[model samples]
Target: MLRGSGVTTLQYTALTVLERRGGISAAQLARDSFVTPQAMADMLRALEQRELISRSPNPASRRELLVHLTEEGRRLLAEYTDAHAAIEELMLSGLSRAERAHLRSSLDGAWRALRPPR
Candidate 1:
């Protein structure tokens, strides 16, 4: 979905998840994205090295690290968001605005319903 829109899938997914979930631990991201913990850690390390994200002390858990988006990360995320929106529009070209909204809402609801309880 991302490469079709001009961004790498990993970059797009990481940015989108960070934008939506705020700062999260690498472990949490592994669970959320369905990626392995080691894979998520590797991705996070790469992102951190690129200055796109920073590993900071977690507010809720002092011993844990939280991944926060840097200014560059936000900029990339904005670009990714635009690309994603364009992809969505192209994919849903035949649907009316209301139908698209309904589909989005229903999908979100279904996902939430299937998620494991906190």
Candidate 2:
């Protein structure tokens, strides 16, 4: 990946999490991503500065802040997801659709098996 693409990975991950879950906290992100609280704080600040994330006080917990993706962030994430899918399709062009599905299932199963129990 190029220098610019490096930020895309982090941005995309954060955007996906926010989009799917609605909102999350910096501490929750630290736990989920296995990063230090400080690291998560810095990352969140960077994302907010880019206008890709919006932060607000949590309604349930005044002390905690909720992080959510801005509309611009959602658009960027959609584009990123489409580009990623296009790349995957190009890479798997040699494989049949069934083969691709099987591979995806196997990989997803392995990932789930390795995840920590809830």
Candidate 3:
């Protein structure tokens, strides 16, 4: 559904992570997004080329580079938020509100269970 938005799935994943975490190192972004370091590097290069994200040396750790979303990136994400919601609504149309809530809770629990111990 977000294909025409000029953002790939991996790019969107990275953006979502940045949106939640504010700014973080590229490596950390890769880890959070569940992508290999090399794949994350390539995705970051593309995002940077699109002016959707910026990279700069981390002030706290010069050895690491911090990645952040730009205004354009945020705007794109905001635009797609409604589209995503609509898709979810359509997908869950057959389910009652309570069922949807229960499904969401179950999915959240499953995700939490799948994550490694922090």
Candidate 4:
């Protein structure tokens, strides 16, 4: 489903990680994305060439560079995310937006109540 958007699963994972974590080091990104350092380096080069992400030297550590997702990266991620909204709309066609929100909240609360403590 994601490849249709010109992004592979690993690339999508990298973008999603950036969206969630904001700016972070490439090594951290690789670890979070479940990729090897060498694989991450090649992926970073590809993402940079596509202008989906940018890298800057980290002031705290001259050896590591910070990675950031570009607006275009967010835009691309949104395309896939928006599809979920459409699917939800179809599945929840009988419910109003408010009802759906309430249902989601109730489900979350139930999950919290049932989950064992870490």
Q: Against the true structure, whose lDDT is highest?
A: 3
Poorest lDDT segment (10 consecutive residues) of candidate 2: 1-10
Ranking by lDDT: 3, 4, 1, 2
In candidate 1 the C-alpha lDDT for residue 62 amounts to 95
lDDT-wise, the better of 3 and 4 is: 3
Q: What is candidate 1's TM-score against the reference?
A: 0.80
Q: List the residue pairs that clash in candidate 3.
A: none
Q: Each model's C-alpha lDDT?
A: 0.77, 0.76, 0.88, 0.87
| Alpha-carbon shift of residue 41 in model 2 (angstroms) | 2.4
Candidate 2 deviates by what RMSD? 3.0
Q: Which candidate achieves the best TM-score against the true structure?
A: 3
* Predicted structure 3: clash tally: 0
lDDT of 3 by residue, 1-118 (tens): 7878888888888998899986898878887888989999999999999999998888998888899999999998998998878988999999998999999999889867865687
Full-model lDDT, candidate 1: 0.77
Off by over 4 Å in 2: 1-6, 30-37
| Full ranking by TM-score | 3, 1, 2, 4
Q: Please, what are the lDDT tens digits per residue for candidate 4 over residues 1-118?
A: 5747878889988999999996898878887787888999999999999999999888998987899999999899888897756866788899988999999999879856754465
Report model 3's TM-score to 2 decimal places. 0.83
